[model samples]
Target: MHSSAVFLIEFGAIILGLGLLGRMAGRLKFSPIPLYLLAGLAFGEGGLLPLGASEEFVAIGAEIGVILLLLMLGLEYTATDLVTNLKTQYPAGLVDGALNALPGAAMALLLGWGPVAAVVLAGVTWISSSGVIAKVLGDLGRLGNRETPVVLSILVLEDLAMAVYLPIVTALLAGAGLAAGSVTLAIALGVAGLVLFVAVRYGRLISRFVSSDDPEKLLLVVLGLTLLVAGIAQQLQVSAAVGAFLVGIALSGEVAEGAHNLLSPLRDLFAAVFFVFFGLHTDPTSIPPVLLPALALAVVTAGTKIATGYWAARRNGISAKGSWRAGGTLVARGEFSIVIAGLAVSAGIEPSLGPLATAYVLILVVIGPLTARYTEPVASWVIARRRPSGPASAPEPQAAAEESGGAHDELADTVRHDR
Candidate 1:
């Protein structure tokens, strides 16, 4: 077959394999990301069908996946959500994510990998895949439960961190050598500009447009603006994800439902291709003879992410059981880590370390979702066994309860909306 025909044939086969594997993953109660990667490994370079394509294509697709993923994530967030919930999640997510990721970096360095590879790998391990967690929680009817918001909060914070830090990390890895001073100044300016533009100019105007009959047109306008700002952010050497995130934040109260509706299908399709292609490109044969060390790094990823998130939740006054759930839920690393590893490999970093880190990330992505799936029952069982139940409350008092009740109501609304 001609090379082009060969490429098309392999690509079609990979997609078919992914669809079958996705069905199996659903039946097995696991996130499809890990299964997808595993399939990729089996069929990619070292396994059966080595297309021998450059890794850069997978890397690029993965990067776009993260960007669009964050963009969709940003649509769900609001300033109110952050101010109300992130106090506990942000610091905890940072500490836990860092703890989980750093050791992996150290392991890489100790094994003679370069510093950029270490940092890139570190950042990749720092994030939790909220999509996986939320799906698990919803399927189990645990979305309104006690630990749900905490998990959501941490995922939100992690996504925010990715938006802010991804560009800086990418820049450094690409050897653009961003100055700390310039980055700080740019962030300040960006925040200020966003505030002035939104609060002063667009806030009232957006309300009118939202109330207008031409909601579709309004969505197009908002999307155009979002992409424009994202372009500007890219021009400023900031992550386009950051810009898109802020735009979503600005429209949080005003145009969220519309924005999400418009963007979600696109996000899903692109994201699917991104992962499928990502798997298609990974050459399992290229993985070095460092399985022992890679496995060690994978253990660190699993242990520290779980422990740190657990500790953070405990410090936030969560029940010990809730903390455990939070930690377990946060353990999965997804597209961000893959993107980071690719960046490292591109920047003169060794392929051995990059693929090693990628390998570990795939393992965690597989395990994290399974842990999150049972968190609620496990937490409720643990907490309920430890503490006696209080007397049943009157409807009046229960209804009058603070944010907890509101959260339940919102969750109910979310379910209704989803259905």
Candidate 2:
């Protein structure tokens, strides 16, 4: 009874605190993620106040948060959208992987954390936060922009890549041998293929089966199904997040829209909890030691992400202004970075990885919005400053020659008329 009372008090306080923090962020016109992380730090191991009883409950909520995040992300598009993005935007995806992922891998190796840590860090740096990007797009009223499709295509491809990447990382973290890892990879691919096939061919059927007029029933059914699939996928050594995402992809039409609306509140709640949980496990003191490296990585990756968006948009023949907007929009890395690092930390791969990732994400998430808003104008300003003050000599000479020739021709025509 005493423990139950403690849990209630602690959990209640945490939720209330999160709510307040979220409201503060909303008023400040920024993401509440960093604030949530700070709160977790304060309540975590080395911070001002540590909670004893509600930690386990918070942990469970955090897992659910990740699941819901991937699931809702999946619902944002149909199977056709995914396939189209994979085919059309693959080059951008590859560029994104190479440009952004390499720095994290290099940093890990330099830190002597081994190849496994390098791979883990690569994922942490590779993915941009779709949730954050989408929110920013809406907030900035850029959803209707020409470059928006290019941005969405790139995000879709990244999410698809995650479906494949997560399984490989899972196998690696479990210390599986080559054969075991290959088997796990094959299974994951097979499951993903099967889900895609089903979603593409019979998504409406699946949705009809799950659909209901009652919101409560719909919510319970969707949530329960997602959890069941996620648990089974985890049991099979696949990513639970992937499983939830696949479940989401298998529903379409009104069912997908309805489920999305019903689950959004839950997703937000659990996602906040997940961020806090990540911070809870990280010691505040550890962040400072790794702050410099984190800052460096954030700066490097932010530029790469901008390049990625610009290249993708330019390839699509968007205007330079649109392309710049596209690049800036993709600069922020948020939830997925934390998710990847959280996996590594939970597996105990590297002790310092968590703190470094936390600090890196904090820097980027805050900088992301600012860059998205200013990258284009800032680039334009710099270019304008570097440009020559006057017209080029070549153009000036050509203009003068044309003017003189026109004058001579007019005089000749006048003389000919007089004669």
Candidate 3:
């Protein structure tokens, strides 16, 4: 009974705090992610007051948060859309890997951590936080923007790539032989291909089976199915979030709309818990020793990620402003980075690697929303300032309007208009 009461008090206090923080963020017109992270830090190890009873529960909630995030994101499009994106965006995924992943691998080798650790660190830097980026897109009302599909396609490719990359990393860390690792890699690829094929081919049938008139029944069924598939995917060495995403794509029309409506509030609540749970694991005292290198790494990879996004979006014919937004949206590294680093940490690969990954993620995740909101406008402002100030130096006004992405600085104008 005493333990129950403490759990209630601790968890209740957390919810209440999150609600207030969300309200403050609303009034300030910004994301609540950084605030949520700080709150978790304050209540975690080596901070002000640690939660003794509810920490475990919070971790489970965090997993649910990620599943819901991906599921809802999937529901926004159809299987056809996913297939279309896959066809047009595969090259961008290659560019993304080369630009972002190499830096981390190079850094690891430069630090003399060897090839295995290099592979692990490469993964840590390559992937962006889908959950965080999804949330930012929703918060900033960019979900309907032209560049969003480009961003989502890149994220989906990364998740698919993880199916293969993770098994190799695990095999390496376990000191498994070459043949065993090859077998695992083969299985991972086969499963990933099967999932995508099934999702695209028979999705309508799945939706028909899941469709229901009653909201309560629909909610229970969809949520239950999502968790089930997510668990099975995790067991198969696939990304649970990707599994959830497949489930979402399999539903369409009324069923999809109903599931989204029923799940939105729950998604928001658990998503906050997820961010907090992330902070709880990071011991504040461990950050300073590797802060400089981490900051330097974060800076370099951030630029690479931005460039990757810009190139991908532009290749798909997105406007300059839309490409900038797409690039900025991909800047934050969250859950996947931590997960990769955590595996390395548990294997006792390199002590400094874990801390560096932590600090790198921390810096990028905080700056993510700011960049998403301002990158285009800031870039536009800078370009405008660089232009020579004279009628003769500038082209015709009509020509300028045609060149500046459908209007003269539409991105900046949108920001100013919003303000």
Candidate 4:
């Protein structure tokens, strides 16, 4: 009875706190993620007012949070969209991986952490926070922007890569041999392929099976199915999040839309808990030791992410401004970074990795929204300032206008051709 009461009180207070934080963020016109992280820090180890009883439940909620995040993300598009993205935007994905992943790997090696840590850190830096990006896009009303699909395509490629990468990392951290790792990789790939095939070919059947006119039944069925699949995937040494994503992909049409509406609130609640859970495990004091490096890494990677977005957008024939927006939108790295760092920390891979990852994510997540809002205007201002003065600059405006007109005409032609 005592334990139950304690759990109730602690968890209740957490939910209440999150609600207030979210309201405040709404009023302030910014994301509540950083505030959520700060709250976690305060309640976590080495911080003020730590809790004892509710931590385990919070941990489970955090796992559910990740699963729901990936699942909902998967529901946003079809398997056909994924395959199309993989085929068309692969070059951009390659650029993204090389430009962003290299810095973290290089940093790890330079710090004497060896190859494994390098690989882990590379992953941490490589993928942007899909949750954060999605929220920002909705909040900024950029979901329908020309560059938005470009952004989503790049993110999809990264998520698909994670389906493969996580299994390999799991095998490596467990000290598996080369053959074992290869086998694990093969299994992950096979499962992913099967899921994709089913989603593409038999999605209508799966959706019909799961769909219901009753919201209550739909919610129960989808939630139960997702948790079951996620658990089984984990048991099979595949990523639970990947399983959840595949489940989402297998449901389409009205079923997908209905599930999204029913599950969105749940997704938000658990996602907040997940962010707090990340903060809970991190010691506040450890961050200072790595703060400088984390800051430096955040700054460098932010630029690379911007470059990745810009290149991808331009490849898709988006305007310069849209390309800049795409780049800025990809700057924030949240849940996955923490997940990767958490794995390494649990495996005792590197002592400072956790603190560094925490600090790095904090810096970027905070800056992400600001950059998304201002990157284009700022870039325009900088370019204008650098232009040569006098007669050269005077006719340049007319020439630039003509160039822009030509570009728009070409874009219109391309759009019509695509149609």
Number of the top-ranking candidate, with lDDT as the measure: 2
Tens-place lDDT digits, model 1, residues 1-419: 58667667666666677688778977986677777667666655666655554344545655556566656666676655644555645676667666866786688679776776677767766776666766666565656655556666666667656655666675665566457635644674567356535744575565455433466786677667767777787677676667777766666554677667766755665566566555555567666576677677767777776777677766756665556766777777776666566556556557675567557767777777767656546765776688777984334332222214335547333322221
Clashing residue pairs, backbone N/CA/C < 3 A, model 1: 46-285
Q: lDDT tens digits, residues 104-219, model 4?
A: 99999988999889999999999998877877876776665667777877888998898888888888888889998898889889988998999999999999999999999999
- Residue 141, candidate 2: Cα error in Å is 1.0
Instruction: Tell me how far the alpha carbon of residue 19 in candidate 4 is from the true structure, in angstroms, after superposition.
Output: 1.3
Candidate 1 segments whose C-alpha is farther than 4 A from its true place? 1-17, 42-47, 51-63, 86-90, 178-181, 184-227, 373-419
lDDT of 2 at 131: 72
- In candidate 2, which residue pairs clash? none
**Rank order (by lDDT, best first):** 2, 4, 3, 1
User: Among all windows of ten consecutive residues in candidate 4, which has the lowest summed lDDT?
Assistant: 410-419
Which lDDT tens digits does candidate 3 get at residues 1-419?
Answer: 99999999999999999999989977876557668777877887887898899999998998898788768766766666656656778899899999999999999998898999999999999999876787787677666566776787898778657656776787788776898777767776676567667767777677888988989889999999999998987675455766787777778778887898899889889878977876676667777987987888888988898899989978877767777878998999987787677667657878777668767877898888888888888877897799778674444343333223342232221111111
lDDT of each: 0.63, 0.86, 0.77, 0.84
Model 1 weakest lDDT span, ten residues long: 396-405
Candidates ranked, most accurate by TM-score first:
2, 4, 3, 1
Q: Residue 14 in candidate 4 has what lDDT?
A: 94
The predicted structure with the larger lDDT, 3 or 4, is: 4
103-159 per-residue lDDT for model 2 (tens digits): 999999999999999999999999998877877876776665667778878888888
